[model samples]
Target: MFRGEHIGELVGNPGPARDAFPIEADTYERLDDEFYAGRIETLTASEQDLLLATAACTYPPLETADIRQRSAKSDGNINVLMGRLTEQGVLYRVQKGQYEYTAPKFHEHLIRRTGSLPR
Candidate 1:
């Protein structure tokens, strides 16, 4: 954490006289991806919250119990909602009975639909 006044001291030499510097090409490219190419279709607040909650959990494979505890939604409702989210490519069926974030895997699909990658 170099402060404005400590930049020269920290570097053990005089710092650049110019205050503004251009970003490296790779860094600028990453910014472009995040700002434009990485944007996903806007999700409803509820869906976004669900995704975050799922990410927080460590339980092997999410079960109705997990939803009941974290989301407090009815068992049947959770099941139905999970199915819909998976079908929508927002969630991935990792195994016969497990799931993972499909964000990285289904990013292509999301990009195709929304014309941008998912955040």
Candidate 2:
């Protein structure tokens, strides 16, 4: 959400420090798309898979059991990967064995990507 890659993508300019930055043409219609996609892109396959499974549920503090029921990645390291997501501020621990996303809209984004209606 806060990356300079925005200017690079939109401006298509690679000027030095002395170059003037564009004051307009600075908006993206799909800010949510850019923000969340960039965030998901930073994760490993394990992390992304876990996250997508969790997004299958409408509510949180999610459990590994929840993911187990929804995904083929039952043996994925839930603890370590969830902890890494927590460290990245993507998720927060609700208890010893449950976690939830920090960004609220991310759930909807995942749902749309996976084409899975909330259950």
- CA lDDT of each candidate? 0.52, 0.71
Off by over 4 Å in 2: 1-29, 74-76
- Ten residues in a row with the worst lDDT in model 1? 105-114
**TM-score for every candidate vs. truth?**
0.45, 0.65
User: Over the stretch 17-51, how does candidate 2's per-residue lDDT look in tens digits?
Assistant: 32544322233226446677888889998888878
Best by TM-score: 2
Cα RMSD (Å) per model?
Answer: 9.6, 11.3
- Model 2 poorest 10 in a row by lDDT: 20-29
Shift in Å, residue 20, candidate 1? 19
Residue 28 CA error for candidate 2 (Å)?
Answer: 11
- lDDT for model 2, on a 0 to 1 scale? 0.71
